[model samples]
Target chain A: MPLIDEILDLAGYRREDLYVCLGCKICSSICVLNEIGIEANPRNFIINLIMEKEELRRDPLLKYCTGCYACTFFCPWEIKVPDMVRAARAALLPSHPFEQAFSSSLELFGRVYEPYLLFRLLPYFFRKGYLRLLVKGLPSFRLSLPKRVKTEGIFDREKK
Target chain B: MRYAYYPGCSLKGSAKGLDEGVKKVFSALGDELVEIPDWNCCGAFEFGEKERILALSQANIRKGREVSSEIIAPCPACLKNLREAADSSVSVLHPLEVFSEASFWDRLPMKRDLGGRPFTPYYGCILLRPREFALRVRDPMEEIITRLGGKVVSSQVKAQCCGGNLFFKELEVSERLAKKVWEGASGDIVTFCPLCHLVLKTFSEKGRRVFYLTDLILYVMGEREFL
Candidate 1:
């Protein structure tokens, strides 16, 4: 309940704010993912979550959300739906490889290493004939060091 | 004028063309762009994840501090992230926005001029989001397009997301968004964000061209060929 309240509060959406969802489906109509066979209709999903209908609470379809803010951009209610999606995503980070890698990369290198991630995800591309990208990207593939700034190490320094 | 330049992750890798073009253009304009050493990637597309994004930007700022306080990055994604983490300590600027400034344009060499072709300036997403930033910028794309003797042909998808970070996470979503931009544009598209350029270039149909703002600027300066 605390987490739910936080998620809702972060978006400035209250229990009463749920009534403002006119069911106009404007948010859903504008979502590109919804049109592309992804069941990412914000109207239905938001309503479900707001009503505490636990069925769709943690729908896997949340992964497809790119955090583009399109629904928030187009919504008449001006609801920050993308924020909600990201909050849900943050909660689901333990299971999603891509997101987990994003976090781990930041933890390890202090930034997401694109080439490393690409190499790790090579199977997804190798099967799709994008192996050439690996070859083309080979020249730039290396552990990036901070260009000019030299810190002892991200974690090595004694906590001030 | 001189500023510390932070060329984010892509600049060293896939977007090196942007790195080269910006350096070339800045040099041509009689300005020195000192690259911020040990600069790390600005964590973009980590929407609503302020803590993560801030840490990455702070890591970059700690590097920038070793240089000068005023920093300019060519990518909107980097600029937005850096600006958010920037406190009273430093200034963050996007080169495109810098180029758009009337004072800066006044300083440009009179000899360099790109032809007046009607090209659509795509802001994609990063530049336009947070609404206030967009307003503060006051349509830099149009300003730069006009400065380059080009026409600004805006489209319905002008302010929409180009699915930048999503290109890796979800290809179809990225393709769909890029396709919208491609279809909506009237002529050669010029974008300020390298991430947007990559996505648009990948999904644009044959015969269509997407140029980085630096690409257009360098082409106009006769340092590079048309994009």
Candidate 2:
């Protein structure tokens, strides 16, 4: 399979989008991770991806690249660094379980069931002993998902 | 005064207070907020991959079209995605924009003062970036904030990314970004976007208070039954 095709499969961004990215370091200067402490520069990463340097793409520090799009705000070329990084992250993953969940949930009900997801994902994190995540997400677990779609009827209207 | 309200997933779940408060505010002003029947999620956050996100957004638009010509979405992320795929056939609006309308304000029964706590309105990146030239971003939050009788503080991070999109993927980075916003816009803050509210609240330190715009609206209306 071609490299761009692989990216499309993994991240869903188009290959043409990547070609538009200039080798500018503006994204690097504004990147939150790089400013905070992480060393994975946005410009360098795109260059590596464009050069098809697969080894550099797999560097563990690349995981810190968040899709905040602050870099997008400054880029003269308007390159979507986050999308590229998200795609690269997807490419690194053996299987994107959460992405699979998002796609399946959207497919089944046309919305993501976040609480149900928490219920399902809790045990895995528990076994992995991510106690902090459990603490933070527990409150969210009580929240309810929206009712499923009801077809063959008029819209649900509320009367005051 | 009647609009097809798209509550998105967050409104139904984590941000239920926003849904209720926004609905109540609309109702109080004699406008009806109708739910977009069988509406799906607005893909929560962007998928970054074009076709998949577009397909999901298109699905939402089709569903929204079935209900009403004017669709009002309270969540910024949802509004952004829905607007991306929404054609000229239907109009898209944020609740703040709807409330800011001169007609709506003229009908408001009473303005409840918030005891003058300073607030900064945060419009996270997606609602204004990328296609910002076309969208013509508006600042209705400040309008509503003042009408409800609150002081507005200038914020350096008004247009900055809150890192809500990265919350699930890179939490450390997300927290850092949220902290970055709070550092710039101190005091009790109110945000127009649910994702920003959630992210800011999750990462906020002890001194900061983050609220959904609807929460402030409801509080001002003296309907104190919010969670």
Candidate 3:
């Protein structure tokens, strides 16, 4: 549980926040992925973390959490499951190509929707078989990536 | 009143339609929107560290203060991050809120009514959830549309998640969820956030038109956006 403590510190949560989740599955029922039967319940992550199931931290399902906060609002105990999900993510070892692309993009570009950074994630997108959707959606919208407000030093101060 | 504007990267990038519409609608409403100088992206979903998120989001707020004490953000994600990162010194406003207020109703140009086109306001998750930042106006979108002489399709899932949050990480679940939202509505869709617009516009079936709030407002004012 010492490792859990360190991760909690990383995500800025008190240990009681994890203990507050009673496995009610309220968060699961409200989850957008779980609503469509994708099994991306945030409750599962909390339980696994409590059990010290370290291997599950790197699960692809963890990536499905969009941190939408649907669960956080519905939780009776007021547990911030998204925070816990992030805590679990802090422990992830970048096993999946997504883990690499996701972090490196944020670390290097200082933002998520960087158009050029999508190339870095192509390997992950291809692996997830999302290439078709990505390709189809690209042309419908504008890409103001070239004119994006310069965000140079923001990433330098905090190396998360 | 003049207000500082923070068009987060999405509105400037993938969601330029809303960005353009924001300028047009605000001008038509007789207000000026000043872009926050050197405003960076409000990092909520990106920065995992609490301090990092606050630092980044607050930095945008600080820049916003240089222009005005009250700031308006078109993207819900950006609004949420800025609101969460903000303290008592300044206030963050969703453009929808500014447009929905009863006092501002007289200011609507109303060049032409919505022509009775049915519009469903997709408030989406980020805009409504976590409660504090939720729009106080009951049925802001419906009321505005109805007031402007448009029909509104009533649906329970107005605050539903469009899967934009998980869009980059994956698509199947996000796509299905977004489709359910679009198909659930009876007519055209009006969205406040660019991610919501992107998701609803991308996966939605052919012939279904998704409108950003600003875009719809502009159209009603006799300026059809150059779609």
As for TM-score, the candidate ahead, 1 or 2, is: 2
Q: Which model is ahead, 1 or 3, in terms of DockQ? A: 3
lDDT of 2 by residue, B34-85 (tens): 8877777666543545555556667667777777788888777777778878
Candidate lDDT (C-alpha), each: 0.69, 0.68, 0.73
Per-residue error for A85 in candidate 1, Å, reads: 1.5
TM-score of each: 0.81, 0.83, 0.87
Measured with C-alpha atoms, the lDDT of residue A109 in candidate 1 is: 62
> What digit string (tens of lDDT, one per residue) describes model 1 on residues A35-122?
5566778887777667656654566446677666667677777676766766656554444455556555555665557766775666
lDDT over C-alpha atoms for residue B175 of model 2: 78
Point out where model 2 deviates above 4 Å.
Answer: A8-22, A59-62, A127-146, A150-160, B46-48, B133-135, B225-227
For residues B1-227, write the lDDT of model 1, one tens digit per residue.
87899988777766777788888877877888888876766766664454655667888887887688789877777877788788878888777666766676666664566667888888876677655343256677777778788888865667776766676666667778678777778888887777787777777777878877777777776777545
Clashing pairs in 3: none
* Tens digits of lDDT, candidate 3, B1-227: 89999987677666677788888888877899999876776764654567767777888888889899999987877887888888898999988788877666788777777778777877887787777766555678877778878788855768887888767656777888898897688777877777777777779787777777777677777788442
The window of 10 residues in a row where model 2 chain A has the poorest summed lDDT is: A151-160
Q: Tens digits of per-residue lDDT for model 3 on A93-115?
A: 44455545655555555555556
